[model samples]
Target: MRTIAYFLVITLICCLAPSADLSAQLNEPAPIRLRNASFEDIPRNSRAPVGWYNCGFPAETPPDVHPDPMNQFQVGMGPQHGRTYLGMVVRDNDTWESVGQELSEPLVAGQCYDFWINLARSKVYLSQSRVSNKPANYVTPAKLRIHAGYDFCDRQELIGESDMVRNYNWQEYAIKLSPTEDYTHLVFEVFYETPTLIPYNGNLLLDNASTLIPSPCEEVVAVNSPLVNDDQKEPISTDPVPGPVVVTQPTTKSGDPQPDPEPQVQLGQSKQVLAVDAVFEVPDITFVANESELTPESSASLQEIVDFLTIYDNVIIEIGGHASQKATADFANRVSMRRAGSVVEYLRTRGIDPRRMFPKGYGKSKPVCYDESADCKRRNQRVDVKVLKIE
Candidate 1:
């Protein structure tokens, strides 16, 4: 009898013990999805993606007819007060309905998810929504009703829409969803108007687009599903320590745009879909022996570094120096320190935050190429960059 009681107790404990799975929330933190977006940073003078239909006035429409000018980054589409008709007009190839990118992976039924995007538009155009024949056009046919519902192709219910549009600059647009039944055909669309009429073209700049799944466990299960077997998630890095934060600043005050400073974690480091490895490399250059002086020849390389930091102001780096075996260890150590300090001082003079840069001397201990040859020693007796951390 005691043995039977003990067995029962053991079974109960096993059942009651916590599982390694996530909680069962309709909007849990699992199963979220994301993708690289192009709309965020509209290229100054580039063509739109393929299959994006342009169905407005013919090329004779004054400023609207011309391709974007070189170095011109602003959208020509005027405000919604009325159509001025002078900008790029593109619609998706699938529906040609002004929707953003299509979901790379289909959605599952009975589950909720969030679709997010960055949008910035002029006051002249109001972004609207709708549903239509699969390959619909922006030219609406009176009877169409655009509501929040499950798109069969994407398998999600369009639960919410954005009211904040126009003149305010780039902001996020999120569509919440919960499909009633599992289906794999449909698309959620946003346009300049509900019943788009007339040639009202306004500029819309977008970026940082993604989809969110409330539950992590659900995401794991979904990934393993036969439907998604062939659809692989972007590879994640194994190392926990990300490489470093990289910031780029302009070398000259001539008004050129700054480079991207987004902190991308090295591959496989992030547990979240939004976390990315900050990929950054210092431009290779030669320095004077035991000194922190910039040669006129090194100007091009140094300028590149400045350009990166100008755009991405949020980054931290370890500007380290090393020495060759020709010098005594202590002397090499001093040279390394001076070399590192020289680089830091130069960046400061060029307007970089001293706090964002760290200088360290490795002496002769850390050699890039450990050969006794003069050339090899020269190669190793140099300064290299290491990205330490990013927030």
Candidate 2:
């Protein structure tokens, strides 16, 4: 069994490794750092928050989500036939440039590392063209090259490309790289071609572009049982999926087992963490005297939830209902499951997309209050709302 498990782990790693010998190089430690190379600020747009950057161009404009650019990049809005309802454009003669810091002073050779870019839009191309291809209108090409070693046109290497058919709203773009030899510096280049002699002003929006020495899979696996390994599972655990109001015990504050002094701040000088606009709390529609169910008072709470969703046409939410210790394990599990299903059914009637909402029920496994008292048990028998992802 042990041998089988070991083989499983190794097979997992081997199967998971991408081409280009990148996985080998990720195992080595790279001094991680960030270099903020941002362009001038343009008016904010609701769609894409992170601005654009330059790769090799002398002058490039920053990214602006707004419909129009005040100066420089002639920003315009367009619609992708099958993609998003709207998209951004770079006016003639405007280019954007940004820089990223190496994870280490000099990238180490022969260690595995992974690189990814957090993307706000997907199916877009990061293209490379010949020095003579200087027409702005020839923007998108049928194919784009992918690699980490393409700063100057001379060292362009295609690592791997992303699926460009589907629309991934502001997601992460990652790639692994392994060096055949060491080079102190590398350049990044992005462009696209679409079989036309259009102007060639390059345009794209990106953020959190990074290169890092990946931690060993074993350490990460130990810490997070279901780390995003060969299976490509979701990073967050969904077993009991956490709920809205997660109450964690405060950490020890003093060396002598004594409390630290409370923090103080002047009025109006402090900032309050903002809450997500989407409301995802479990509706108070049901609970038992010693169970998880509806007691008639839940209707109002449930209605409030429905109303909230109706008001925000674009909002999406997740509901996680929990049970108390009063019930047996089997009973609690069934009750929690029922509550979750009921909530989903109720919301469906309210015209919310079933695809947008995720309902999970965790019986006594996740309790707000650990005590066995009646009051504590009641408090534990609660529902929670969380905004999983906002559009």
Q: Which segments of candidate 2 are over 4 A away from where they belong?
A: 1-27, 37-54, 57-104, 120-168, 193-203, 215-391
Off by over 4 Å in 1: 1-112, 122-164, 167-171, 176-201, 206-211, 214-264, 267-283, 288-315, 327-335, 345-351, 386-391
lDDT comparing candidate 1 with the true structure? 0.43
* Superposed Cα deviation of residue 165, candidate 2 (Å): 7.4
* Candidate 1 residue-wise lDDT at 48: 30
User: What is the per-residue lDDT of model 2 for residues 1-391, given as tens digits with 9 covering 90 to 100?
Assistant: 9999999999999776674434333333543333322111223432222212223344433224323334223334332211112123333343423232232254445544445543323233222333445433323312122444423233434433432211223334444555543434443434344333554434444444443434333221111112233474323222312112211122232212223333221111222222454333343456666554567777777755654454333556677677778778988888777777777777786556788778777888977677768778766777766556656
Residue 24 displacement in candidate 1 (angstroms): 6.7
Q: Report the lDDT of model 2 for residue 145.
A: 28
User: What lDDT score belongs to each candidate, Candidate 1 first?
Assistant: 0.43, 0.43
Candidate 1 lDDT over 106-131, as tens digits, reads: 45555556455444443332223222
* Residue 362 error, candidate 1, Å: 3.6
